[model samples]
Target chain A: MLVIEGLLKRYPDGFEALKGVDVTIEDGELVALIGPSGAGKSTLIRCVNRLVEPTEGTIELNELELTTLNRAGLRRARRRMAMIFQNYALVERLTVMENVLSGRLGSVGFFKSLFRRFPQDDVDNAFALLEKVGLEGLHDRRADALSGGQQQRVGIARALMQDPDILLVDEPTASLDPRTARQVMGLLADLCEEHGLAAIINIHDVPLARDYTDRILGLKAGELVFDGPPEELTDDVLPEIYGGEDWSKEPSEDDEEEEDIRSSGQFLAEEVL
Target chain B: MPVEQREDTVVWRRRDKRQAVIHWFVTLGIAAVVLWCFKLIADDTTWEFVWSAPEQGADLAIRMFLPEWFVDIPQLWRDGELWVHVAEYFRQRGLYAMELWDPLVDTIHIATLGTVLGVMIASPLAFLAARNTTPSTTFVRPIALALLVTSRSVNSLIWALLLVVIIGPGMLAGIIAIALRSVGFCGKLLYEAIEEIDENTRDAVKSTGASGMQVLTFGVIPQIAPAFAGISIYRWDINIREATILGLVGAGGIGMALQSAIDTLAWGQVSVIFLAILATVVLSEWVSAKARAAVT
Candidate 1:
């Protein structure tokens, strides 16, 4: 379980990115964090991993306080949680196998990792995760040689290699197309289910978030406004979280086109499973 | 204002009248200064010698081309020798060929060793100088940058002169000079490359809970590997050319041969030495180009 109590982040310029937010997540729960741009969705997830350090309050993962750990202690804490990025941040020149094996860097000695020598079990696990993510035969290829969707799959494989308790994903599908986005999300959902892993995914697409995740948390201007199951995230609640937009408006032609794409995305998601 | 209203339609001029006038005056001032500098140079030049330069150059070229491959051609001619002079010419050529090989080999060794040593020294300094990789920007980076600048400010020839005096004339002096000069060139470029690496990729690696050194190996090094390779090869190519001249300062290479030939007025031997240096430089250039292309 992960618990955040009064988590606050105020930048040096005195901009409050997270305003005393509190939340708790149980194991096996895959939750979606939705907000408009600059609503602290990214900030909140980063704070959990201490990537963006919190100025005040506490973040506890499995009852271990994260905010006050020293350098070595933080590394130990970080091993229990993994982060995925929007850009699929693979070392572009490195081979896929190397990139995946890098996830075990914290566990290995410096010289062993430096010489590209990972333990055989780590290598075997990397191969297994590569196969699990459907990148079965491209392990020798450089990261930049893969397509964006393929790269994101490699990113997922790398994160899974960490064997972490929680996955902090920051806009994983933001750079992907609609179909590929749903497929990647579906893969994450399936993997989380199999491992009973807790995850906080920051997603922009409302329908996709609602489809894949069990729960949704809405942030608006550094404050948590709504936290509920996906079924309870109604149109009335959206205006409160997203602010003053007409929730009951008639669907436009563009909305109908989007509906078609979403339906096709759903089909692709099912195929991924 | 750059945007103004004219009658009904709005008029947009890139520069208003005041800016245009300022620009024009600036151009005129630069032109006047250039003309004055040209006049100063013209006044100081001796035109009489300048006019005779072509004839002097042609005479020197003629002397240089007539290589001294034969050891006493005039004496052989005076004694009424025919086939004997030809045999003597072949013998002298053979002897000269034997003399040239060692120094040419020495020059190659100097450059190769110098480049390796320089890269070994520069790689660590590059990390210290790079803003992203340095342990402290204010304290560590400035010292590293100062070292790089000091290395770069002095030319390899000057370095060779100092080393020859201090270390006693040999290949060691030539190697150290080349390595010192290369430290700055390699460090500056390597640091710039490091600063431009993809930070997002590094962040991802750090998020894996890797140690600082591990993050450097996995996150930073791979991104800068190609740039490092290209810099090393490019520096080696330049060092090959520089190594030839180091022998002039008693740092052992083909340059020592050239200096002795010039001192004895053996223009032909000087020409041959020049040709050998040219060939070595061209070969190194080609090799460096191919190596850099392969890495990139």
Candidate 2:
């Protein structure tokens, strides 16, 4: 289980990104963190990994307190959690195999990794994870050579190569096409099921999150306004989380398609302006 | 601030009236100062030499056009016996005299060795200077910057002048001079490259529980590899040109040949040295360009 108590992140400029938030997540839970832009969804996920240091909080992963860990202790603690990025942040020049193997850097010695001499077991696990993530024969290709969907798959393979207990995914589908986004989300959900791993996914697409995740945590301006099963995240609650946005319309299949076209058209109009 | 509402119309200007007046006065002041300096220079000038300069330059060019392919330098060979045969053999093929070959090779060595040494010293200093990579900004960065600035402020020719006196005038002096100058050029460009690296990619690697060294190896190095390569090769190309002139200060290269030829009033041999230096510079440019293209 992962537990966060009074998690606070106030930047140097005194902007509070996470305001004394408290939450708990159990194993095998696929929790979707949904909010509009600047709503602290990304901040909360990064804070759990201590990528963005919290101003004040206790982040306990499995029984160990993460916030209090020193440099070496933090590295050790971080090994239990792997993060996925929206940009699929692979070292673009490195081969997919090398990028995947980099996930094992925490356990490997510096010289060993420096010479590309990863342990044989880690190499084998890397190959297995690559195959598991549906990148069976593309390991030798450079990360930049892959398409958006393919690169995200590589990112997933890299994260799984760490053998972590939980995944902190930041806007994983933000840059992807709708179909690829859904596929990636489905894959994450499936992998969570297969490995019995907990995942905290920061997602902007409400329908996609509801479709793939078991629970939804809604945040608004650094505050967790709603936390419940996806079924409980009704239209009425969305306005409270998103703040005054029109949520009365039915989000049916056809309506979602219309919304996609409308949004894209709005983007095109803005670009022209 | 420059926008104004005049009756029913709105007007926009790049500058307000006061600013435009100031800009006009600044331009007038600059032009007046330039004319005054030119008049001072004209008043102090030797007009006779200025008028005869074209005639003197043409006469020199005619002499330089007929380059001497063979020369007897008593400093070379075993008391002139070996020199005659070698000069005759090379002159038949229209190649440079044997005296120029050793110094040409020495110039190449100076450039190559200097660039390698510079890269060695600059790599660590670059890491210290880069904002994202430095261990301590307040303590270490200023020291690294100071070292880079010291290396940069003095030209390689001046460095060679000092080194020739201390190290006693050899290829060693030329190499150190080039290396010292290169450290600043390479370090400044490399650190800027490091600072501009994709922070997201680095953060992702750090998020994987990678250690500091691992983050650099996997995250940072790959991002900056192309920039590092291009900078090093570009510096090497410049160092080749710089090395050719290092011998002017007694640091050992083609410039020594040119200096000696000028001292003996051998204009033909001086022209040959100029041609040789030009060809070497062009070749280095081509190689560096190809190498930089391949990496990027």
Candidate 3:
């Protein structure tokens, strides 16, 4: 289980990216964080990992108090939580196998990693994870040579290679097409179920999040305004999260496909409720 | 739409006439300055000597090619043992063809060793100078930048001269000079490469709970490897050229031989040394190109 209390992130320049926020997440649950741009979803996720340190907060993962750990302690704590980036941030010049194996960096000694002499088991596990993510036979290929979806698959494989207890994903599908986005979301959901690993995904696509995740946390302007099951995230609640946007309007021509998905998701949510 | 079009037209028409006048005045001022500089040079120069320069160059070329010893080559070749006669001729002129072999080898060693040393020193300095990797921006960055600037400001020739004075003239001085001169060049390029690495990749590595050193080795080094290899090879190519000339300051290399040849007006030997230098430079260029291609 992961618990965050009174989380605050005020930048050195006096901008608060995350206000006092509190949340608790159980293991084996997939939670989606939904908000408009600059709503602090990314900041919240980053603070959990101490990538962006909290100004004032207590983040307890399993039983470890993450905020109070020193640098070395923080790194050790970070090993249990893997992060996936929006950009599929595999080192583009490195081979796929190398990028996947880099997940063991926190566990491996410095000289061992520097020389790329990862233990046989680590190498085998990396290969296995790559196969699990459906990137088999691509171990020798460079990361940049893969397409966007393929690269994200590699990103997923790398995250899993850490054997993390919890996954923090930031806008994982933001750069992918809709079909690919759904596929990635489904993959993340399946992985979470199979491994019993808790995941918090920050996403912009509300319909996808509603359809896929077990719970949704809606953030608005650095504060969590709503947190509930997908059915409770009604159209009226969206305005609070996205700052007074008209949710009942007809879809524009450019957003026709997304509108269909939204309507279908709403129908599914009503049926489940 | 019509109102917007009219506003656009009015804005285009509202040109400043004084701007054009200022432009013309600036142009005329630049031209006047250029002509004055030209007049100053022309007034002090001898036009007659300049006009005769081509003829003088041709005369020197002819004399260089028509030395008495070179003219006797054909006559000597008429004898049966041409190879032996040629060897004897070189022996008689005190130019034993083999005398330059050690100096040539020393030049290559100086360049290779210098490049290795320079890259070794530059690599750490580059990380310090790179904004993303520096330990402290205020404390370390300025010192690293000052070192880079000071090394780059002085030319390799000047470095060789200074090192010769300090270290006393030898191949060691030449090697140190080349290494010192190359550090700034390699450091500047390497730090820029380090700074330009993808932030996302770095963050990904960091998020894996990797320590700072681990992040650099796994994330940063891989991205910058190609740039590092290319820069090192290119610097080595340049160092070969600079190493050859370092011998001119009594630091040991082919330049020492060339300097001696010039001091005695041994133009034939000077030509030989020039050809050797050209060959060495071409070889270094080829090697550098091949290495860069292989790396990238």
- Top DockQ hit: 2
Q: Looking at candidate 1, what is the lDDT of residue A208?
A: 85
The reply for model 3, stretches above 4 Å from the true place, is: A252-273, B1-15, B42-56, B69-98
DockQ for the candidates, in order:
0.80, 0.81, 0.77
TM-score of each: 0.90, 0.90, 0.89
State each candidate's chain A TM-score: 0.93, 0.92, 0.93
Candidate with best lDDT:
1
Task: Please identify which of the two predictions, 1 or 2, would achieve the higher lDDT against the true structure.
Answer: 1
Q: Please, what are the lDDT tens digits per residue for candidate 3 over residues B59-101?
A: 7666544455566667767865567766665674456346888
For candidate 2, the iRMS in Å is 0.7
For model 1, the local distance difference test gives 0.89
Show pairs that collide, candidate 1.
Answer: none
Expressed as tens digits, the lDDT of each residue in A64-109 for candidate 1 is 9999999999999888898899999999999999999988987989
Off by over 4 Å in 1: A247-259, A263-273, B1-13, B67-98
lDDT of each: 0.89, 0.88, 0.88
Per candidate, the number of residue pairs that clash is: 0, 0, 0
Ranking by DockQ: 2, 1, 3
Best by TM-score: 1
lDDT string for model 2 (B1-296, tens) is 58989999999999998999999999999999999999999999999999999999988886765424225445445465665666664484355556788999999999999999998899999999999999999999999999999998999999999999998999999999999999999999999999999998999899888999999989999999999999999999999999999999999888888888888887767777887888899999999989988998
